[model samples]
Target: MQKIRYWVVGGEYTSTDFETLIEGTERVVGPFESRSDAERTWRYLSEDHRPQAQVRFTIAQEPQGTMTA
Candidate 1:
């Protein structure tokens, strides 16, 4: 299975404000199985918790095939 990394952005509302917003909330980020899953998670968090915040999902894949020796 391929490993994926998920990053949660737009949490620049200051430590105090962010803490207040995230209180009683579970993790807003995750490692999903696909790009669509990652996007969905970002959308859910942005809409329900941070409507004014800009959210984005990025996926990085290693190039296939052998490299020149």
Candidate 2:
């Protein structure tokens, strides 16, 4: 089975449309073992940056290869 990992990606974007991110504002936060953990971090980041209209964060998942039984 493929082991999946979660991550918190995104940061300050150039516009409200969120089509592009600023040059140095890209923020990637970790390969969490569980989606809940990633979500926790995401909530914190989002709330922390709530004052900035351009700041944003989202949860992402990726495969971490197969796991042996």
Q: Return the top candidate by lDDT.
A: 2
Per-candidate TM-scores read: 0.40, 0.87
Model 2: lDDT of residue 18: 92
Clashes of 1: 0
The TM-score leader among the candidates is 2
lDDT of each: 0.47, 0.89
Worst 10 residues of 2 by lDDT: 60-69
Pairs of residues at least 3 apart in sequence or in different chains that clash in candidate 2: none
lDDT of 1 by residue, 1-69 (tens): 335454444443424334433333334465455667777767776667554452222333333342233
- Please give, for residues 30-67, the per-residue lDDT of candidate 2 as tens digits: 88988999999999999999999999899988755643
Query: Lowest-lDDT window of 10 residues in candidate 1?
Result: 54-63
TM-score (C-alpha, index-matched) for candidate 2: 0.87
Which ranges in model 2 have alpha carbons more than 4 Å from their true place? Answer: 64-69
Q: Model 1 compared with the native: what TM-score?
A: 0.40
